[model samples]
Target: MRRSRLTVVGNAVALPLLLAVLWWVASADSESIYFPSLQKILGAFPETWLDDGWGSSIIVDGVPSVARLAIGFASAALIAVALGTAIGLHPRLRAFVEPILELVRAIPGPVLVPVVSLFAGIGDGMKVAVITLGALWPILLNTIDGVRGVDPVMTETARSYHLSRPRRLIALVLPAASPQIFAGMRQGLSVGIILMVISEMFAATNGLGFSVVQFQRNFALPEMWTGIIVLGTLGLLASLVLQFAETRVLRWYTGLRAADHES
Candidate 1:
């Protein structure tokens, strides 16, 4: 436990130190790459983010982008989990759908942006559709894997208890499958965030991506850098929160793993 905790702390320290060194190195050649100094970039963040009422713009753009992502992701989750559970329980359905799913997943998400835009017209609908397309497959595939991976003994025990179909699924399958579902969700979230930004960059009038593009085109390098940094920070925070939640929710699974190691 102590070693694991130290490892986490070490990584936390090392990553920032590495980033600092990289920032310094990159900025040293500022004359060539036109890179901003670390301090200058940090200093400009507040003005770019808050001054000129970019705060309002960010809120307007960011809120809509996030709302689209959330709506799309939630819809995808429900559909994926339901379809995945059905496919998992039925071998024929799994075989029938797996290839189609694989094909969809294989297609690059960015490629669909144009098609979605064409159909949906650079609107929130298009953005949500693309985000859903990008996020759904991982969750569906993971759900199938998780449900199928549940121990036979557990299923047998549930059946022996005369559990109803809904009760069995709710009490047994879901709990057994949660870890993999969460894993899928993590993957979906990563893809979803990327898609959200890409969709915004391609068409939106306001958003982090739009702001970055606006700054770049206007030669506001400091602001562009600030936008990039803020986006990175947002991704980092989202991933950390998800990971922490996953750990808390799967404590029993983690404890079981630890016990097995001890034995």
Candidate 2:
């Protein structure tokens, strides 16, 4: 297991290093203002990101962007799981409300940015609301499916044991449904990131998205690229954190799958 993990880490580091080397070679001595050399981008990274002793862009822009993503995604996941659990537990309720859900999910999240801004007024509330709205559907739908698809035998067993509703939810339902829930959360995380940027694109100042756009408008290609790099790094870190949490939360599921594979 340790060897396998080491190999994974090695591959992750090696691929990016190889790509950076290739890009450095390819763009060396290039004079294109639009696509600056990777070297120039790297050179600008510290100054742009850490402007004025690290309180300029990264601290101001990047932090809020990530905070919005975390809040929105976490809220979406929590609300979806709760609603999904309740709806999945009742067949009639699921059937009745599903169409409305499908209808709402059909509309793209970006389309609602203007609408949301009207009510929320172009503040952090607007951005967070947009992110949450955009991130909500996938997890909500997946959680519903996960809960509904929990093992029937396990459900019956819990019933026979006369477990309380909360007890069953904690001991059986959630565990069984976790794989699907994680899948949804993974999908939702990406949506949340996209929305974070798009939400900041309009009527917002002091966010990573705003900074990136400002850089581009002024032809600060290196700084724009740096902002993108920072955003990408944020996404990577968030994904790693989520994966770590998933590994801990679903350790039993992982072992079961491994055993099945071996068998």
> Best candidate per lDDT, number?
2
lDDT of 1: 0.81
- Give per-residue CA lDDT, model 2, range 1-263, as digits (tens): 67855675576568667888999999998899988999999999888887643234677887888899989998999998899889988999999999999899999888978999999999999999988888888998999999999989988999999999999999999889899999999999999999999999898778888888888888888888988888888887787788778877988998999999999
Candidate 1 lDDT over residue span 92-155, tens digit each: 9999888888888898878888999998998888989988888888999999999999899999
Cα error, residue 96 of model 2, in Å, equals 0.8
Q: For each candidate, give its TM-score against the true structure.
A: 0.88, 0.94
Superposed by TM-score, candidate 2 places the C-alpha of residue 253 at a distance from the truth, in angstroms, of: 0.4
After superposing candidate 2, which stretches have Cα over 4 Å from the reference? 1-8, 53-55
lDDT of 1 at 28: 60
RMSD of each: 2.8, 1.8
